[model samples]
Target: MARTDTAFRVIAVPPARAFAALVDPAALTAWLPPEGMSGRFDHFDARPGGAYRMVLTYADASAAPGKATPGSDVVEARFVDIVPGVRVEQAVDFVSEDPAFAGTMLMVWEVTGVEGGTRVDIRAHDVPAGISAEDHAEGLASSLANLAAYLER
Candidate 1:
């Protein structure tokens, strides 16, 4: 079956602030990578139909193999939808030769105001078979934690 993973966290910030963190390329550069990885974007345009490409490099080369090159995974993505202070979505495709990883995926981020903070939910749709679900989930969780840390700072 095709796999889609979802993760959520509440941050101590308003929805507008949370939305900014999600959509701003600079903020993304600060917190998008999961633990043990770092990312750099080739270009980022946040408007609808805009596009971006990024390369994520593992801190340890051994950690990247079949899923990526010796040390990095490259992704080309487009901004699918963006609703200020509410939601953002992107269509993502990995730049890989392996058929198992040759597919376009969708990622959505929803931000809503809560009593004391903002509720942030992220959904990754149609994950490639080459990526382990457990590791992906951990990465998502780690990203959320990183975002929280960045926001709090």
Candidate 2:
């Protein structure tokens, strides 16, 4: 069965700044990876219909084997929509041979300006069965925290 996971964080930056971090390759490489993982993009183009390939490597793969390889998760994602200061949506797929991880996931990132800063909400739809809910939640939260730090600094 397909499932959805959502996470939100109040970042201490304006919506534009938060949205910029979402699309900039350098900013993404700096903050998109969750705890214990590091990410790099093979190619990046941030626009509607543009696509990018990202590889995420685990610092300690023994704890959690990757979906694409023993130590890494590779993702190919296309931009579905990009609304400045509001939202960025993407169609993402895991580059894995395993059947459990075969599917295109919709990742929507919405940023709304709040009193103190921005409220960033992430909604992931049709998450692959191979990814556990608890782990995904933690990963999302970790990435959000990283984003906050990246922007606030």
Candidate 3:
């Protein structure tokens, strides 16, 4: 499957601070979820091959879809690689019975130092057919925007 790519620039925040917002569990909880969602991590281990589980709840129950419950979406993930203040790669699978949403997808986040801030580029490989590219792209953009906002503050 073709991958989905998204990139964003975070002004006034260096690579280290931007990368911290990516790896830190507390910071992740604050900004990982896109607009209208809240996230909780059951456990997070920030190392290669480490496992984690995250539950994302929709602020509006009506916004949830068939692939997940009325108010939440669950994901089981493992860190494939971690380069401090630089990049993070992970393999993620949705905990849903829906066939279209099944399967593991690789997500890579590249952080680079740019003039005045950091540039974050994200790619999702083998994205499930159940998820539309448009929505995925939007969600990614929103997450990146969230990260920028969190870091700049």
Candidate of highest TM-score: 2
lDDT of 3 at 131: 88
* Native-to-model Cα distance after best TM-score fit, residue 130 in candidate 1, in Å: 0.9
Considering lDDT, which of the candidate structures 2 and 3 is the better prediction for this target? 2
Residue pairs with backbone overlap in model 2: none
By lDDT, the best candidate is 2
In angstroms, give how far residue 6 of model 3 lies from its true place.
2.8
Candidate 2 structure quality by residue, lDDT tens digits, 42-138: 9999999999999999999999999999999999999999998799999999999999899999999999999999999999999999888999999
lDDT string, candidate 3, 28-135, tens digits: 999889888989999999899998999999888786563567678898899999998888999999988788898899998988898878888888888999888888
Candidate 1 residues lying further than 4 Å off, grouped into runs, are: 66-68
In order, the Cα lDDT scores of the candidates are 0.89, 0.96, 0.85
Between candidates 1 and 2, the one scoring higher on TM-score is 2
State the weakest 10-residue window (summed lDDT) of model 1.
61-70
TM-score of 2: 0.98
Q: Model 2 clash tally? A: 0
